[model samples]
Target: MLEKIKRRIEKHQAQPIGEQRTFAVFLPLVKVDEEWHVLYEVRSNHISQPGETSFPGGAVEEGESFEEAAVRETMEELNVSKESIEVYGEIDFIFNQSHHIRCFVGELKHINPDQLQPNEEVASVFTIPLRYLKENEPEYHTVTLKTEYNHDFPFELISNGKKYKFGKRKHKVPFYRLPNQFLWGFTADFTHRFIEIISEDTNFLEGKNEK
Candidate 1:
């Protein structure tokens, strides 16, 4: 079943598409223990997107394809060579107000936590069980604005923060919870969607009694 998914992704990658956009690859390290685990990273405070939790990936450079960028970023960030990764497939593409995200999934045959190079853009690295994410229910909230258009945004979860209210109007600064990780903004959205797709596939295969 994983092979089938991989073939479909390769076909998509091979097709030529115009209007190329900035793409990123997210390598989700899955551990096969009593339960499945997925790796995550905390962004370094020095970076613009600081304290944010995300997978190891960045913008695709000029003349670089999505796969190349993914492989390169993974090697640089995790210090894990390309040969150690077994590309499985890709997750759904997530588009934010700022950028378009192209995500891919690969397996790590071996991992040495000590060898991980968390640069100025990355603070720390960690892993959490997949079941924790699958069971958590997210709460979405919105805020209205008096801009060109009245916009209401959705925030998955909230933390202990200030909630401001106007005359019949209110805005809440919320923080999203990802079990052991905290996710927000584009990275959060991308990871959430990726997990949803993988979980669905796993469930479908389980129902069919396929290994």
Candidate 2:
């Protein structure tokens, strides 16, 4: 039994239980006239969530690492080569009940946004200065997530039955107002958190920029 357990554990990768969808996004930093900017993509009209502003990324493929997925998606969406991207590091990740997103930060070298023809999944690409993002604040919306039990739930089997008092959670949905774009949802949340870590809460970005 011990040997069997060891084998099974060695083969198992830690992941959330039940149905889960994993994703990856690359935050591309482009240096323009000595200022750093972050690139974003507008989803194509034919794709899901068309007109929404998001980073260049997509789902993680089988047998691919999260970093590789980010690079592949960026190349596909932006029509760039892997050599053009210099991945600084992985910053933070985001997750929900059914979705897990891994994020990576990188710099795009020697590429003009206007010159590249994005794939069908991307309608257009735009960039915003990182300094502006660090200087501003994002508006937040709080939402409560309440669990709903199925009618056939076996409450009798648990110590807490119908009156078991399942816990409810509160989530903060962040919204960032751009000049001509409405950046919100998980995209906005990730950006906001990134800025907070490097600028507001920590001096990481500043330190990185100095060197």
For TM-score, the strongest prediction is 2
Q: Model 1's lDDT to the true fold? A: 0.67
Off by over 4 Å in 1: 1-21, 32-34, 145-181, 202-211
Model 2, 19-125: lDDT tens digits are: 77899999898877777788889898989999999999889999999999999999988999999998988877887678989989888999877687999998888
Cα lDDT tens digits, model 1, 54-173, are: 788888998898878887887777777788777788877866445577888877666655466756677898876666655653455667644231344322233432342323444433
lDDT of each: 0.67, 0.86
Clashing pairs in 1: none
What TM-score against the true fold does each predicted structure earn?
0.66, 0.82
The root-mean-square deviation over C-alpha atoms between each candidate and the true structure, in angstroms, is 12.8, 3.3
Q: In candidate 2, which residue ranges exceed 4 Å CA deviation?
A: 1-14, 148-166, 200-211
lDDT of 1 at 5: 96
Collision pairs in model 2: none
